[model samples]
Target: MAQTSASPDVATRALPATWTTNLHLSSDTGLLQEGLDALEGYRKKDPNKVVVRFRAIGNAPIMRQNFYKITVSNRFQAVIQFLRKELGWKAGEPLYTYINMAFSPAPDDTVSNLFKSFATDGHLIVNYSTTAAWG
Candidate 1:
């Protein structure tokens, strides 16, 4: 059998035994700490209250004032249900809502977390439409 030689670069290169540990420590520790701090703050928020402003889209009817102060512990579903009732929508009728005209959140998501992440100018701008809107 003929012998094969490894490339010079490959032969000279050696893997560090503690590469994983070094990588873990070196990978954006400051950003990681900031993220952890944000998470801690999210988890430790007091009162857990958020203010929301609802805006009608397209042909949707406007609400009176349309601003509400809600508890952060409430799920997104409560907002939907409130809207449906306010608009006198039948149970089977479809309604769509989005945050900051960006995206719709899950019904089970907490209002506090959503407010912390998406609220602007001291209020969460909730856009609603009777037809399908943004994803």
Candidate 2:
């Protein structure tokens, strides 16, 4: 289909001088400051490798080498898979892993973020159990 284009004269027309001059302005500077603070809070500088300490919960078997170092860019699922391999757990078996015995991070959560938020004494404590051990 043939399309008609705007005339050169019409295309070059400028907007009214007052159109941009009278634009609404916000008087609340506090909101802008809060937004800046929030942005600063969200940014976290991560290291190349994160130290992960695996701890047994309840009747779960303990890993001989509790401390394992992994790249910061890895996701939480990689940690879970490594634990399962060490414990010889099948794919369908129930494995509950938590950070600092507090909460379970999502599979897609980055190791760097988890380490940044929950690492203690330069190690990220990961608790594991065959069943639910904590709320």
Which digits, one per residue and each the tens of the lDDT, describe model 1 over residues 4-35? 55465557775566744455465787877988
Q: Per-residue lDDT for 61-135 in model 2, tens only?
A: 988899999988889999999999999999899999999988999999999989888899999999999999775
Clash pairs for candidate 2: none
> lDDT scores for all predictions?
0.85, 0.87
Which prediction has the highest lDDT against the true structure? 2
Candidate 2, number of clashes? 0
Residue ranges of candidate 2 with Cα displaced over 4 Å: 1-47
TM-score of each: 0.65, 0.65
Model 1 error, position 1 (Å): 44
RMSD of each: 9.7, 13.0
Clashes of each: 0, 0
